[model samples]
Target: MSFRKILVANRGEIATRVVRTARALGYRTVAVYSDADAQAPHARLADEAVCIGPPPAAQSYLSIPALLDAARRTGADAVHPGYGFLSERADFAAACAEAGLVFIGPPASAIEAMGDKAGAKRRMLAAGVPCAPGYLGSDDDSDERLLAEAERLGYPLLVKAVAGGGGRGMRLVHGTHELAGAIAGARREAESAFGDGRLMLERLIEHGRHIEIQVFADAHGHAVHLGERDCTAQRRRQKVIEEAPSPVVSAAMRERMGADAVAAALAVGYVGAGTVEFIVDAGLTHYFLEMNTRLQVEHPVTECITGFDLVEWQLRVAAGEPLSAWLPNGQADIRFSGHAIEARLYAEDPYDGFKPQTGRILHWQPAHATQAGRAPGAAASSVRIDDGIAEGGSVTPWYDAMVAKLIVHGRDRADAVRRLVAAIEDSPLLGVANNGRFLRDLLQHPDFAAARLTTTRLDEWAAAGAPLLQRPAPDDACWLAAAALAARGDVPTSAPAGLRPASVAWQTIALQCGSDTRRWRVRLAGDLVEFDGGPSVQLLGQEGHRWRLAIDGVTRELVALRHAGGWHLAHQGAGFVFTEPSAAPDQRRQADPGRAHAPVAGVVAQVLVKPGDAVSAGQPLVCVEAMKMEMWLNAQAGGTVRAVHIREREAVSAGALVVELDIDTVSTVI
Candidate 1:
């Protein structure tokens, strides 16, 4: 039953991954893309490509009819929904089957059973699987009853949507004071994300480690577990970094978790690649959180450790192959060789609440010597990068912000972390803001190195105002900018005409970054540049964006890229930006004192204040949702709302005016 052609019904890196495996299996591949992804890498990699619809996911990737029509036209006999979008939708899977196309995933019934968090927990309880203590009862149909249930669960707990995955429609309630707000917000978000507002409760396991087992099954009714991955490094309940063969899991715990994961998968008569997720508490007690009924974003780490392509297994299993043919001895005593860690390179600003960024990627470079698509060797320092976008690609606000997944392999955990750090040091993504530096910082933290990571670690770091979150000093920024400009031939070629190198007057240079603006008086003479009353700088040479230079007898290499009429620099896993002061956008803000603009690019989820309404200082004027998180736009000062410029659910760019206030009437014009 091997298929002749397969239609990939997903986008980004996962799409490319599925195509790669299909090509290896000697199958023709068809790729479907939206208007925004017309020129994306995955589109070009496939043998045949078709335009699905617009940029919004609902009209394109998530539309089952569009996908079936595309498959029908392309003569594709099978459809591979790689990870997101329609990957986990039971209706989509059923539709694929109804269209006579092989769906390379679990059965529709399995997906439906596990898709609902409350139903899944009930099934797990019936099967004797250890799940977190909470209220998933069907009797609590009212919000007031749910609040009563939360009160019984005590102070700290989570309100999660029954049909939601990925933290969307999820909220944390610290106490009774926040329960109502948490429930309402969680419900709204759940309804918006999953089309269902039904929620369940769980006692928040403080400092818990997220671990999941990779399980596989086939139409032959055989299933096996391929070890586990630790995804404890998280922020806002979303995983930031993941590693396989968890450092904290012993051999005994691994076996127990694997058995439990296999049992959970078998309970629903599962098939294809699936993951069973669990939360491990401080005392090593584990509880089932949920099961993802498709391939995971962190599957590469597991592949790096096991040397088996999970996508290939997916395709093979769908072709009616038995699980024993792929998994060693039906996954009994599965062996794991090396350690691997994956870092998700997202287009978001780590410094600004990790807000999603939308812009054209002017430059993109992965930090690995070996190119992607090749299997990493057994050496401890092998690197691999799997990405969906390339240079000149755009990151829009319509989908997930992840640009790529950087994975590194090693013989052990320490070696893997070291290699990962080295790889992260060289990765440079320009044009849009990203969290690369923040991830590198977290990797090197003493607490992380000592295996102290947890679901709450990132929040703790933010609350403590960790120094790693700060940008580089202004002096360092100027030095790097000067060197980059010199390397790119942007500096002056000659000294002052009337004086020797030592007697020339300093040239004035203005630089602006983020909010701060600084002016540095500098002099450029050949490869030697001297700042006013500062040390002389020297630019040795440049290889791509990596620059080598000596400042005051010290040598260092820095990653620098020119974009948006300025230079973006990274050193020691910290990023900084420098542009001519005039290029700063503050002038626009200063031009209109009464305008309240969108702080970040996102969809306006709600408008809290209306026109002609008086608002107090710090009162929320609007709430914008971006990067899967919501942020409030507050009034700078007490004023009467003059006009509302944007509507709810409307997309707004950074600095786009959302509201205008009557500033002069609230105060004095002076």
Candidate 2:
């Protein structure tokens, strides 16, 4: 039966995506949001919006009761679980079916069978699927067994939570000596993160490529594979960039992997959109990783290559459609059109351990221009940007830190990389610390260009001192000149005064880039500009729309354009925006000292330190659990724990004081 309305039980970009697809399928959409997302883009885009609970995901996105109530109140006939949260929870799926709402996914039994990594591995091995050599026995005294298995599998094995996904609840053991500690840590994290302490072991394949095949099944027991994607470019096991039609995958290898994926899905009686992940070793041998029973974040790249909307197919399958025509004899030959690559634009700081960032998006502009060369009627053109937030939208810390997914398609991988680089160059976002520059750097790296990648690439890159591909543009010189001129009262005191030429003491300014500050001295002499202090700067005559600034006798042209309440200097294929009131102060301050606040709203999972206890910097003080994940709140500095305001399992708000520290001594370390 075709459902009239569907409730998207998710947040952020995926929620908006489901709603858009539902609207296209002539179905009304309902969106449930936490307090933090009440004004989010997804809520406004839905046909109806309901406030589920507080900003914390536990009381909102992960609350089964709240979700059921929202569905009932909004008269939604079906629910679409978009990738995370309750998407793979068997209990949630069963509850939805009991409530008379269609669960647009595989059966609950299927989820339960495949949700546990150990059990899933057993089933796959039994079904003749290639699996990594490890131990997945159900013995409480399995520590000795795991150590033995680690020895046989050699050094550097992975201890993964049986019920965990993402990179959480996982630890890498380099040798037998590290096995016990890694096992204990992995179990603790597994229990804290997934509410299950069970774990298993797998051999860590060195120099492996992260590959996955998309599988679609229907109600009629029909299934088909949608080729494979190369997600080798990753950071901390989290994929940073993804592309369709892996350059390293041979046609014969693709067939073998696709066949195995189908067998795994069929073994589970799976239906709807799902991904079967695999890790391919250097020898091109593949092993089953796990199956994600929902649409993937990188589905857009597959859609771009195949010209098929996986979400639409999911809806059709849920409505009792068959996949007979899509796949003949349980397999179909897939062809790739052009190369497609996707970059996840996140509000994060790569230099700061890839920490999550949140704030209002003051400005947003995506690159939408074609490159220099292109066939007259080629399928590739400009970039196709898909985002969930607008200019005024807030990037709350209560959810995933992804701001948008930028995808670009070109005739080949080289052209695709060039287009992606151009898109990042032309794109602009302000008032938030985003990883746009980081994405550009990763794309142009020699390692990535050579396709020699693995899951540990990002961690390895960071360990080698996080190197930036490009430096901040030389636009700071223009800002220094403007500031110096303004201080002397030579330029008219007005906003946006940099646009006009001024009679200042120095038309030429010399600025030295200090360790933490920019020191400037200026001298002006009519149209003939010259500087004496520091590096000699000579001003060349300004051409139309370009400012010619000479530094150390080298003439360089720059574009001075007004932007973001200030001026933007574009030079050397890079653009840097400078504001009058620099925000350097806020960036250097310690994590808000205004009381011991909850960094994120969640139930207090554990309180490690008591009131009045002396704590040191980097000590874990509290653990907050949200969305089935545990986040440790550490001490910002050494001090006496003056107060423990919140109890165990107590729900707290973002920035709400959970602990107070009395600092006896101040250290100059931030």
Candidate 3:
């Protein structure tokens, strides 16, 4: 099965990722993109590109007919379904085969066998692989039977979709009273996400780490495991950080897990790339999780440590090449060098329950300059940025919120963590609310440094209202910078570009960050500033989004980027957005808690209340779904519903009013 051209039937970073390897391997690549991704990096990186349909995935990326048409138009001989949309669909493999195109993945039978969570669990169990004790259902998945099975499996079990992965179509039931709702919600999500409402129950491993082994197989009956990837750093069951050669998995443990993962692959007669997931307890006992029968999103971490390209492996296997051709020593040749860590960069507000954010990327500069444990002028950087977004690009709500992936390699785990943290902190991603500061904070957290993270650790911190969720409050120096910026008066040089010793002196402004307000009056006369409540401030100079200043008698350099009529300042890993009420009033600066408003831009999934309906404080009144994540707009204060401004299925922008109640507005945290 030799193919000269490969069509990538996906978008974003994964599509670009596949195109990179295929191009490097001397195969011309074709990219099929939706209207939303016409100018996306993936579309531009391919040898040829085709516009499939409108932005809606059903008409574009997820449409098999559209993909086949694109392939035919480009005269492509192979199709590479980059993870996510239709990547795991067995029918897609069969369709590609029928269309006389090579699907760069395992056989259709393997995907079907593992696509269903229950079926995969049963198969793993039959293959002598230990599986989590659960009801791999026998067709009777009714609410009553599932509830009964939940009782037997015990409380705090996991309700999961039988046909999907990625924490979607999954719910955690902590008690008997929650089982029914969990079942219903999980089913709805499962149906929506995977078109499969079949449910399964698994006894929750109260304390465990998420571990997966990357396995590759070829048509010559050769299979090998590429070691383990620890994905335990997760929030809401979605992996945020992934690292190779898990900090926890010992050599012996890796052997056992790797062998089991390979067996799980061979059990299905799998060919190409696949990942067998597992959950390991403190006792070192591991249970089989479902196997993903395609290349994984975190495959780069495996590649970094092993010095092998998994995508290239996929291409070779799809072309019917034997493993011996690429891996002269098979499993023995697979080796780990140094440590590597990857953190997902998402376009979301970490301070606001991690709400997904959508807007254009006014500025996009990652911290590629941060050399890892080397000289400042190191010739090469160990940092690798797997990003699909570009400056001036729009992060539409129509797709996943992840904008880029930051992966770093170092001599050790500590070195890698340090480099990654530096990369995240120095990266300036403006325009939309992002998770850069939050990622840095998480990386610097003592718990993460000590490797004390569990699957639910982030959730637990959030539930406890830990300060980890809040943005770092501005200090005196920060405030001085903000005030100086407001007073800088970015006008003609005659007025003062930025404290250029001009005749114009006195400037007073009211700056606000969140609920904290500060009234500052700066009288700049001949290099002397009347700032502070006297905290210390002196604008040394300004250079296009950068400022050198003396604050509190100490010289410091900071980034002050202006976007959307607001000032965005950054230093170290802290960022604060400030707005002047006298000029452009920020909608969020004084938000009304009694009114119903969307925290993000998304289609209204449901409206739980109507006009004149009585509601209690904290009761969910509306549901908004974006990028497959749901956010509930809850009543901040109990009162009679005065009006419902937005209805179900309506699309709304961030801070768009949805409902209002007849009550005095109360201050509430978003």
Candidate 4:
């Protein structure tokens, strides 16, 4: 039953992850990609590669027939559907079985039973597992019926889509006034994302800790639990930081929870790696959430702590290898050691409501720099960066925003946090906005350090804003930028041969950053750049986005990247975007009096206001869709719409003008 070749039916870090282990075990690996990922790292790393379809997931990764076709064409004996896409799809699993291909996951019946949230809850109840009290009604349940169910369940419950993962189809309703709109919005988003609008109600656990147990099973009926991960640090219901061996889960509690998780797995007769999630309240009471029927995104931390490759276990179990062969004594003999933490590196702007960023990765120096030929002892202090994109790659708005997973292991929890912070600070990533600094700040936060975490921790910090936020770009950024500019031949060298060094013309350069403009006056004498005769500055050398600097008897490595005219600089955990002064129109300024521009790149989902229509301040003008989420563009001030430049279904780039408004005494038109 051993596989000769394994087709990784996925993309990004997870796909590359499977390929790495499969090839190591002497199995040839095949990778599938979309048009946007033709040059993706996973595609180029595999022994064989195939283009599935276009950028959109439906036309490619999520297509069952396409995946099966790829397996047949590549002569693959087995298919590994990495987490997401069709990993939990029962029909897809059954299709693989029918095609005489081994689906390296649970049986179709197990997936079918657990894929339905309500059905899984019913089974959990039957298996004596504690579950949150809620209404799991039938598909025919109408809006009125759902409203009634909410009334009975009480306010502040969750409106969750039964068939979808992520936060796509989730909404929080504190009262009945917002219940209807929440339901409608959740349904619409769920239908668009997962093709199923079915929903369920659950009691919202405020300030609760999200804990999940990793369970692995084999065809021989042997199952084992591999500790738990605390994923309470989240934003928008998606986990940002995950760590193995929850701080609150004592030995007694771990044993109880682990046993319950094992029961949940055995109840469904599940095989392969799965996660049983639960919500732990302040009083230490736990409630069953849902069971994921595939490998989890946070599985790396578990691997780092347990010293076992879960993906390898999946392959072995699928090849008819008994769990007893790997572990003679099963769950009882498994040992847990040390601590591990993983942070999700994403191409998103944390300052801007975590808006997804899409663009070219001008430079990418991963956390540990590279994954090849590293000495074994380096693993102790090194941060493991499981990344997917390269320096010249473009992160289009076609898939998940996650760029990599930064996992670090240490002798203990405090050591792990320290290493993680240092790793984030040393990471060289540029060209797109990210939350690396924010993650670093979170690791050092007093609450995080003291293990005082809950689901609402991120939300609380976001609401406080500025003072509580991560450190902003420091004043040293200017010094680094100036050094980079001087090194790039922006400074006059040797006084043009005619004039003496004293007669060299003084140069003044104006730089604009954000909303502020600053001017620097300097004169360059060969390698020395004199700033009003303050200090003789020398241009060392440039390495990627970083520059080695020697200023005022201090030598330091500064990160500075050149864009069009100015340089992007980062110091500590903060980043600053500096643009060189140019005569071109200022995009951030209100140059065109009444134009309303798009703040982010996305497709126009709806035009809320028509031309000549009056709009009030904060009124919805248009709705833009990007990365599977919809954002409403509201009017900044009350005005009358003069013209509409964008229509529904049209794609718009960031900063594109979408409307012209006539406000008070001014009216601008195109």
| Candidate number of the best lDDT | 3
- Candidates by lDDT, descending order: 3, 1, 4, 2
Per-residue lDDT of model 1, residues 13-94, tens digit only: 9889889878878999999999989999999999999999987676888888899999999999999998878888899999
The segments of candidate 3 whose C-alpha lies over 4 angstroms from its true place after superposition are: 369-380, 491-501, 523-544, 547-555, 583-595, 607-621, 634-650, 656-670
RMSD of each: 3.8, 6.0, 4.3, 3.9
Error of 3 at 76 (Å): 1.9
Native-referenced Cα lDDT, model 3: 0.83
Off by over 4 Å in 2: 137-154, 175-185, 188-193, 325-330, 369-382, 469-516, 519-606, 612-670
Residue-wise lDDT of candidate 4 within 1-670, one digit each (tens)?
Answer: 6778999999998988888888878899999999989999999999999999987787899988899999999999899999888998899999999999999999999999998888999999999999999998796768888899999999779898888776778887889999998898788777767788888899888788999999999988879899999998887678889998998889999999999999999998989999999999998888999999999999888887777878888999999998998798888667777888888888887877788888888767764533411211214444677888898888877778888878888878999899888888877567778888888888998888888888877877777784446445447446534643643354333335444234356786566667566666777665556666455455566565666666654667767766666577766655677766666775675555467788678777778889889877677788777776677777766778999999986778888999888875542322
Candidate maximizing TM-score: 1
Candidate 3 per-residue lDDT, tens place, 1-670, comes to 9999999999998888888878777999999889989889888999999999988676788899999999999999999998888999999999999999999999999999989888888888888999988888876778889988888989788999999787888888889888887787788777866778998999988778999999999987889999999999888888899998799889999999999999999988999999999998878799998899988888877877877778888898899899999789989988787888889988888788888989887767665543111111112357877788888889988778888888887878999899898878777677778888788888889988888888889989988878889766877677778887667655422344464665455667788887898887677654446663665466676666667878767888777877666788876655578887656555455556677778888877788999989887788899887887888888887778988988776777888889988754553334
TM-score of 2: 0.81
Pairs with steric clashes in candidate 3: 117-162, 532-535, 596-659
Clashes of each: 0, 4, 3, 1
Candidate 4 lDDT trough over 10 residues, lowest sum: 369-378
Estimate every model's Cα lDDT from 0 to 1: 0.82, 0.74, 0.83, 0.81
